[model samples]
Target: MHEKIFEGFCISSFILNKKLKVALTYNLKPEEENSFEYAMVSPLSKNSTTYNDTFAEWDTIETVNSIKSALELFHNVIMIEANEDAYEKFKKERPDIVFNFAECAYGISREGQIPAMLDMLRIPYTGSDPLTMMTCLDKARTKEILSYYGVPTAKFITAENLADIENHNLEYPLFIKPVGEGSGKGIFNNSFIQNKTELQQRLQQCLQTYNQPCIIEEYLPGREFTVAILGNDSETEVLPIIEINFSQLPSGILPVYSFEAKWIYDTRQNPLDIFTCPANIESSLQEKIKGIALKTYKILRCKDWSRIDIRLDSKGEPNIIEVNPLPGVLPDPSDNSCFPKAARAAGLSYEEMINKVLIAAAKRHKLI
Candidate 1:
């Protein structure tokens, strides 16, 4: 079944045009001996305490190589580390297009750096543009945009210090995370705060550790789902919705899918039964989830693909949790990455999923 899917995808690619010169640009997580170097040098890593999870958002060599191999099936592929030398490399190689998933090393706008360079070079790239990338990286900014556009999102505020969190009208039991970090960085079981004291303590610790503003929002007390979106404009397709089974988590932990839940408790060795693809919800609720996900994708101007997380409010209506412009695509199914899991539920193999993104970008750029 997977073989036939890949064969059909390749035939379609040939019909569109010959194989493309595709550059797979990403930040490969450093080796163990050098991992601390990223923590020490990162401008965002301000506290003296060593943070081993500094590179949590960056891709591993296995992930990078897997993406490269997938792209290689339908295009000429090159590996380009999105680093200080990325601009020079892009200028020299000038691939026909870029498959970018670089969670850059420093700065609040780090995620936009590679896309910005690609924009300046007038090179086509997969995923959202620089403005959208930077905006979505800042949780507060993304929520603000969604709220203004009449999209349902949690009530939230940004705090750079404890004082910034004080005297807020928001109720207790709020959730918090670094404003600019993703891949569950700085998020943990303790991120769910119950009262003023916990809020203040967590805010101070997060500010010191992340050296960035923290977004504290009212905690939604209902089920959570993630929607994977593909294509553009009127033709956008929302793939199967995946519900997060917090019940699968260990006893005595918060229901939030924190860094521990994502990278610690859940692993390839002993994968948790934590996800339900094609979530067994009534048709009406499913449509509501899909509608909001698609609206959020368009409002953010996400180009080729994205994964939008949603959770039900107290009223049982879907509200946006967060938008992931460059969604993770860990190839191994055992790893349980959301985007690929959703794709497989929609009858697309891993290779088909990767090429579908490339095809969407190529069609958008009129390069096919």
Candidate 2:
């Protein structure tokens, strides 16, 4: 049991020092067999605010279970479903810390809900705070904040209406994504627009699909990579960067990774070959990527851990695409979540990565 449990972990004083009650809170998606069918049958009335409110952002039951086990390895663990009843559970648990993975049920501020609530409860938790969560969820806001810090990011324009994009100065071959979504929501093959007609069509699709403003950014035509950062301040460390390699993808796949590429296609047989850890790049390039990632981390005031997506500009320079404070930690190895993949690349097992996040949060809260 010890060998299997601690395979990717080492005994640390942090765990040996003390054992405290830790709350593992997550919003696990319902695993109904007809979930998709139910969604398809639902009325798509324009006035219905529920339309597009709930996304695939919720965690899976297995993921929550795996996280619970990891937390239990070093501390007393209690499960808290992040929902209307969360307060009741919190009162009962009174945990020493909260390991948060609740992406929430819906809204532009979905990811911030739980963290914001925890703030009111005065309970310490893992990952970024409410303000940071909301800011990072809005892709345009993230770019603006990074740009203000002189961080390199692809030039972007937010379009509330088609007219907002009129007379835009951004170069052609732009990328279109919902301004306030994560997990590749609303990003499809047509996301990469090289012509005005494609741009107009894709923008309309994003606007109609998400019922939110879309961001039109001067697309980075070079390599794309995601870097994971853990720890706070001087202790912060950038995990091994994972490059999204598309060579194994079927022919005619879009140059840009979209929702279909991430969730629909690349199944068990082919699997998702998009991840290539310890990316092949010059040492100088690696250093440059890490430096920019750390700088962005500090500027954003992100705590615990985060996964930053970056792509190269035409000049082979790295630019921040989006910063994800609540990065997915899918437990299954077959799942192509980047944060866990990067942790695995750094020789940390999935269990270890999860616990490290908890420990980091604990340290940040001055707990044990």
Candidate 3:
């Protein structure tokens, strides 16, 4: 199985003798949302620490160190936070390229802020551009685009408030999620709305806590899988497919891969046996999954690489859950970062995953 999965896996796109100066931009957990409200209130805010929480979404110091060390092997690396001081710091130490992992401080365009900044400076970075980031951040908007392209995704409605959900008789057993948050933030067991009362309560809570509307979509009752695509649009490779098992969750917990399931239950010390690399499936189904992921990646015009979440629907067809252009790359083996896990599944080490991305960006920027 490993032999089949790693058939054509290239560890790195470029083996450069010249060391490029790369600015590694990221938002660390403690430094996230460094603002006046954050000063007065706790960094997690008055709302549920899990919902709309920037801290959880922010990368850890270990992650920054891991990426920096990995890139240093192939380039000159400098770390910078995507905070207020980021502009000045970046301007002073203007690197040739930026390996951006910043998730912004606030606003609907938050995920795209760092990318937009780099664009203004005419500096190249890895991952999708501002428009792609913003579009992908809004779950509803992404689904709309996928739907337009005839890409199968769960039918969903975006609600700015409870009133937005009042008019129509939407489907039940819907998946509720913050319209613009990522990394499983604002997702919990109760996110699966089975009835009106559940929808009303969860939607209201979502609005109040996340300060954003919730997307109520048809729930996918089949298996969950995350596929990582690496390389440019014309030469992208889909890494080994990953099947996530929710059977490890304690009794009564929804089978969905919610925030608690990701951050709380799946710890490094005793990682849950919740994943099957090179997912056990027939050859035809595997090809179908890869095709769907590649199609979604191209439609979004994703640059360099992306990890797309795909799930099976009631009729046994693959559908896109969402695309993560800047998917999490936590270095720790215990941390359940889907991208890294998939990379390892395909025989690429953590360093290989990090360097492959930098090399892809460099080649795209015509640097090497």
- Model 2 alpha-carbon miss at residue 135, Å: 0.7
Q: Work out the TM-score per prediction.
A: 0.93, 0.90, 0.90
Candidate 3 global lDDT = 0.82
Best by TM-score: 1
What lDDT score goes with residue 323 in model 3?
Answer: 88
lDDT of 3 by residue, 1-368 (tens): 42243334333333455667899998776653654213212425355444334566777777888999887766788988888888788778888899998997798798898888889888889888999999988888899999999999988888988788887566678889888888788888889888888889988988888888888889999999999999885778899999999989989888988877877677776689898898999999999999999999999989888899989999989999988888999887777788999999878888878877877788888876
For each predicted model, how many residue pairs clash, with residues at least 3 apart or on different chains?
0, 0, 0
Query: Where is model 3 poorest over a 10-residue stretch in terms of lDDT?
Result: 36-45
**Candidate 2 runs further than 4 Å off:** 1-18, 32-54
- Candidate 3 residue spans exceeding 4 A from truth: 1-17, 31-52
Model-by-model lDDT, in order? 0.87, 0.81, 0.82
Model 1: CA > 4 A from native: 1-3, 33-51
Worst 10 residues of 1 by lDDT: 36-45
Ranking by lDDT: 1, 3, 2
